[model samples]
Target chain A: MTDGLPMRVTATGLPARVRIHEVGARDGLQNEKSVVPTEVKAEFIHRLAGAGLTTVEATSFVHPKWVPQLADAEALFPMLRDLGGEAHLPVLVPNARGLDRALALGARRIAVFGSATETFANRNLNRTVDESLAMFEPVVARARQDEVHVRGYLSMCFGDPWEGAVPVSQVVRVAKALVELGCDELSLGDTIGVATPGHVLALLTALNEAGVPTSAIGVHFHDTYGQALSNTLAALQHGVTTVDASAGGLGGCPYAKSATGNLATEDLVWMLDGLGIETGVDLGRLTATSAWMAERLGRPSPSRTVRALSHKES
Target chain B: MTDGLPMRVTATGLPARVRIHEVGARDGLQNEKSVVPTEVKAEFIHRLAGAGLTTVEATSFVHPKWVPQLADAEALFPMLRDLGGEAHLPVLVPNARGLDRALALGARRIAVFGSATETFANRNLNRTVDESLAMFEPVVARARQDEVHVRGYLSMCFGDPWEGAVPVSQVVRVAKALVELGCDELSLGDTIGVATPGHVLALLTALNEAGVPTSAIGVHFHDTYGQALSNTLAALQHGVTTVDASAGGLGGCPYAKSATGNLATEDLVWMLDGLGIETGVDLGRLTATSAWMAERLGRPSPSRTVRALSHKES
Candidate 1:
């Protein structure tokens, strides 16, 4: 296995091994109208880790008023921690208060999210762009002091629902700020899933030129427009080693009315396996996990891989 | 606009423009369990042409005993000819009898189907690989003599359900025979939707090295495992300008149990538009057309673009 180098490019021009940052428990469940029980959420994470995901975003520390679906984060985090696996359970922290709650629960890694566009920042984070960055600054600083790894998420990096197509320079400036503020990794998110491979290549190339190492870059894509896999390929070709995916293709953007599911972990794993890239994930286990979760959700998984495999199995 | 010259490669290593050969009416509806009315089928072609699709495959001349869905090809072809748009209505011709029926209906363009793998050739065409090629020889020669354009379809070029992962050399041999037999173009079919981008690049590279022009290669992909668009991107990067897509993501291989819909035309058009590639299809009308057809079929369109646009409009 290759070390977690910032820019590990293989002979085939892709990462030798990719870290799939599982967000199904956090991002995927948060978007659902039906609130999942805390126990079910914990089991989903356990199953995901059992499927070989090293990094699992367990829960978010947002206020219940904002995200009632994840209101059981406090109850869920300790259960996930008690499972005692090698997986990194990262929690989403909106500000210092959320970080403090996560710290009290012994979260070793936490993520802070900001928006690339002002409208999204105001709507999602309830603050101006400067205010949102200011909000995360102390949380990131405190996490660094406590030896906690911080991952930063920049949403709408390609296009915004209100602001339309975002400039690459705008994304680069905010990404640089997050790195300077002690974020160990930054995820460029297509929140509305409007990105194509050309936009992905252009943005990642510009970010590299602006001094953000590709190794510290992860891509979080939604499959609303069916471009996630193609966009992920572009990211890998540019030497980005971390990718964010949701099991059973869970999650949808609340701001973008037309957006659908996140890039399915099973679909991503299938492509990586086909390309002969190492992901340390078992496709059969992942497929079974998604199928199990899909039954709990009382609906079929939107992932083509999950559907194809499930249909084949049945 | 670039000429349809064989082997045209732009500086960006992509074709300047792609010719979308719409296969909705024939290959798409042919697999449906419910028979589409001839009038609705006629309207679908009219709407597709109005949306600026230059080459639309109308219906197949295969005997209704084999494909009852396209039983009205005789009635359908005459109606399509009376509509009289710039679209080329290429009907599938199974053999000399099918070709004779198409000729009697004044069909100017037709496509013959073959198989790359031996088992698939025997199972689908009821002949061995050599026997299948021999069966198409006289049909292609006669079509060429009548000044009618002919396209050849090579199924299981990437993978066969019966005999897994067909070799690239086998596909090249079959493709070369079609071209030598006066087929104007060859559409390589991933009948099982198991192809990844790496396989696509390798196969296309082998074919080009084998003296087949890139311009004459069209990719027909299924979205079963969500690899169609990614494969299409790889094909375009290799300078292949022709793509086969189905409106509303219609079509499945009745022989292959797991294969799903063909790559949706609207989805392909969205990516092409985003990449700044010129495809003369109108996105709005195409969405409307798919939505209208979906209503007639009593289901929502399987196309992500059509769904997204319809959702946004509603």
Candidate 2:
């Protein structure tokens, strides 16, 4: 239970309520070394939504050749259709083909992936930034026509493994293009987790100046460099309401060797709970869900909240 | 290298410079599972100073029966006496006996420990809060008479394991007593690592209002709940300049089973480096020193910055 202290430190500019876009079932399991069973994935999603997460990234509708881990997306999405009627079950769509497959499965929400740096775009997507944007243009247009909600993921927004620190202007350019092309929301991602709070402020300011409103933005940070929570806090102070996190600390950057995973949803909830920021998520249930998943993964969850909560329970 | 953008967002009230009091050699190794050899401990301290940390907490002079890991304090203090001329090598002295032990070796800087919760003080030090404060009175007084600098550590300032959430008024009372007893600096410690940024702001505000100058206050946080850096950021934004961090994220909490060690120096340096706030800590060298220590500990350094930097080098 939170003490219900003064929630908004008005001078600090932190938000009153934060939207946590849970990415465990999609972005998290997709990076696992082993393929999670379709039933296990569905159960994981069910448990997440049961924990009061309003938005859970369900699966990726990508080509199986590219990501074998998420090859069960077609099966996964259909099985999760009955859970959490109001929950946003956004699936990652690489192109028009992926979008079509997601639509075929009756997915109402989908996401397109883009990258800020040319090197990451070329290597990860086998296309230049312009080519990648071109590929997503048709998918976004069709999604808009279908009256489906679409989220755009801009990766390498902070730094590229090969190109080093990316300029704020470059991230802004990609973010603007995604929004212009018809994304309902854009999730700026630090794929390598080299971001700090100041960098988050700089990039967000640049994006805001470029005319992409902060209301349409969410932050996705990896915990690879342990800057994710601080970066998320900065985004909150910057008035960005939505944040992307994974349950049980489930994913790692496939691009950055030895990198950790996304910011843990439980850890994020701990901070939000302490700040008295409304997230509509149950910390106890979330911790239990992560603990269950961690037992299945045969390792301890890296989420500090999950670890602490589980220890308390034990 | 920082991009050198506007370092201080004037409205945020963050300090232009932060003083990092390195606590790895003392707080860190004291909780280590294995006893570090005296020469290795000296090298660790030397390497920390070489990494540009000007205030490395060297060792503790507590009774060996209480903290057997720091039994070699006499040998360690003399060994590191000539390493860094400008660095303040502060040692932790529990009472007059420990103070006499440290003073015998010409220790110039020493710290006295106190607790905000009566339960922790009684359990950890075998004295109630008032009794502990009474015990430290003569010690702090004698240290002041010797013209040696003294720091007071107020543990459980936010929460205690036995007592759920510590009253802010209780923490302020203990803090005021320590300052009135002639402590040169007071380090407010989140012993259980349960503090969030909001809690940090509330506690700091209460302390400031109770006549403890923000300038004389330092924050010591553990990453048990992964809230250390975020809490530290909040403290910075609230105008506190001094922070305590451990190298390689060494030292698990002997009390809190699930708690990690102190906030890692490398991680703190990474954030400061990005914020363009001056800490004078060499990120690369700090990472290297942690890596070296982690080798001796038979594990990889838990500091995310250390892991990321070492991976980059490899």
TM-score of chain B of each: 0.95, 0.95
Per-residue lDDT of candidate 2, residues A119-222 (tens digit): 88988899999999999999999999999999999998887777777888888888989999999999999888878888888888888899999999999998
lDDT of 1 by residue, B217-314 (tens): 89999888888998898888878899999998988888877889799998888778777778899878998999999999899988887887788778
lDDT tens string, model 1, A1-314?
11110111122576778999999999988988998888899889998999888999999998888899988988999898655557999999998889889999999999999999999888898898888889999999999999999999999888776777788789999999999989999999998777877788888888889888898999999887778887798788778889999988988877666557799998888778777788888888988999999899999999998898888778
User: Of the candidates shown, which would achieve the greatest DockQ relative to the real structure?
Assistant: 2
Which residue pairs in candidate 2 collide?
none
Candidate 2 wrong stretches, greater than 4 Å: A1-12, B1-12
Could you tell me the TM-score of candidate 1?
Answer: 0.95
Error of 1 at A170 (Å): 1.9
Q: Candidate 1: which pairs clash?
A: A6-A215
Error of 2 at B254 (Å): 1.9
Evaluated at residue A258, the lDDT of candidate 1 is: 57
